[model samples]
Target: MLRGVKREVCLSNLTLQHPRPYLFVTAQCDHRIFYGCWRVFWATYHVIWVLLSWVLEPWVLYSSSERVKWFIYLTNWTYLLLAVQAVTEAVNFFCVHSLREDIVADQQAVPMPWYLKLQWLLYNIVTTGSFMVTAWYWAVLYKSDTEIGAVRVSFHAVNSVYVLLNLFVTATPTRLLHFIYPVLFGVAYTLFSALYQLGGGTNIRGEPYIYRVTDWSRPWKTLLMSSLSNFLAIPFMHLLVFLLRLMVGRLWECWRGSGGSEEGETRRGRGRGVTCVDLGQRMTESSSIQAELLVSCE
Candidate 1:
């Protein structure tokens, strides 16, 4: 009877130690940096991006054309860098999975859990989608004026699609999406901000939260804080952009009026004397013809 009990105990221990087939897949699927420090870092990155895109670009737009060109160049490089980072992370995920067998016994490897699989899928979608949108936006900046509008539309559409998809994919009755929504926004804002700042592109007038370097404490901290700040700041940023655009419009109008007044005064002074009048009349006619010619060319 004692020997029989010893054998039963051994069998029970073996059964308890046996690994499930789905465990490996499930672990892989669920392995995401969603909680704690990861989430904090993610949030910070986005907040910076948003601030750059919405604020810095517009401010820069008021600067010289040479500066704008330099800005655009910076943005393109930044987007490419970010895309590389995302791809690297994805590769790391695969690398870990490949070595799973060595880490765990065959019996313990379980199938992938549904939620973990979903998370992985969403990660791929968001990263790829963001890369594509940012790349296109940069490309458009270099292209002719005619293509810029279309490219802008495409960027917005892609962005909307990804954001909505994220919402749908993560949605749960428990309101898990709410907790994660802030995180996602932070991520998007960071990406968007980085692209905007590096590209030298300004935010759309109605959009807000232009990224600023001063807002960040350090490189990594900036990335994380910017992302996290999106939850509280994005709406305010939007309002700020709107008001800023209005102010910009007023300033532009004033500048245009001043320029027009100066030109009119110069033309009138040139119109005063007989020979000068003839020259002025001829010049006026030439200017009219030039304007017509330009209009036709357009």
Candidate 2:
């Protein structure tokens, strides 16, 4: 069976069924600590990225002769995603605290806004998948950019993994279809790049292409083939996240014995972990109310 919560951690909404819901305990039940840690991590990463950008090349920043990239550009988008996660998780952490304290446990359930829920889902999907794509593309196809020296290499390769690993330990299992948002995010960026090229907007090196493969100077056939291939890569990255969540969730359930017994029966008799409830009813509840996700698992 999975170990029970420690003093700082509490598990809620634990049920064994086709679609299981279990809360991940945060490092703290307090909002301040949660927010403080996020700020620390954010500050550390931004400092490093800035130092690397300065060392490697100054042009990536806004003051350069290059066009001013959107605040949503490049690594900044993932940073925004992280910021959103920090805010949402901090609130959820406090909510879980209230739930455990029995302050809100019996109160009438207040549903979260649909957009807020959607934001959480997209935060997981887009942030992780986009960073993965950035790293992979730079490693494989981004030859026209300066040979990825140490700074570029770290930004693309090692730095992207920060969000990936963070989400791995923090996120709950969301449905597979929500992955479409990440695909849309990639397509939107590609469309923006195409428009920028048509307008003759260039990068720091004053190159017409944002990342080289989409260079306007490329033959129509070459660009078409490359764009198509790259578009397909987005969904693959989404699937990678899906599989990672599934593996992590399953491992957690098994280790905790949160699911039914190895024989697929409820373990209520043993007074251990699993408790068999009516699977049919649980499915209906998950589909309706429980799936709303009132708090972060962590």
Please report the candidate that would top lDDT against the real structure. Answer: 2
Q: After best superposition, candidate 1 residue 200: deviation in angstroms?
A: 16
Off by over 4 Å in 1: 1-86, 102-154, 160-298
Compare the candidates by TM-score and give the number of the best one. Answer: 2
Candidate 1 overall Cα lDDT vs. reference?
Answer: 0.34
Where in model 2 is the C-alpha error above 4 Å?
1-56, 60-108, 114-122, 141-154, 222-231, 258-298
Give the Cα lDDT of each candidate: 0.34, 0.47
- What are the RMSD figures for all models against the true structure? 31.3, 9.6
lDDT of 2 by residue, 1-298 (tens): 1111111122332211112112322321113366447635654564566455655655445563443453424454554454455456555545555554432232223333343354456455545554665655666566684566665555566555655665445534444444556666656666676777788887665677666666766658546844564466655665566555544543433343443324442211111332233222322111211132322345
lDDT of 1 by residue, 22-50 (tens): 22122211223432233334334433453
Q: How does candidate 1 fare on TM-score?
A: 0.25
Q: Which 10 consecutive positions of candidate 1 have the poorest summed lDDT?
A: 289-298
**Clash count per candidate:** 47, 3
Q: Write down the TM-score of every candidate.
A: 0.25, 0.61
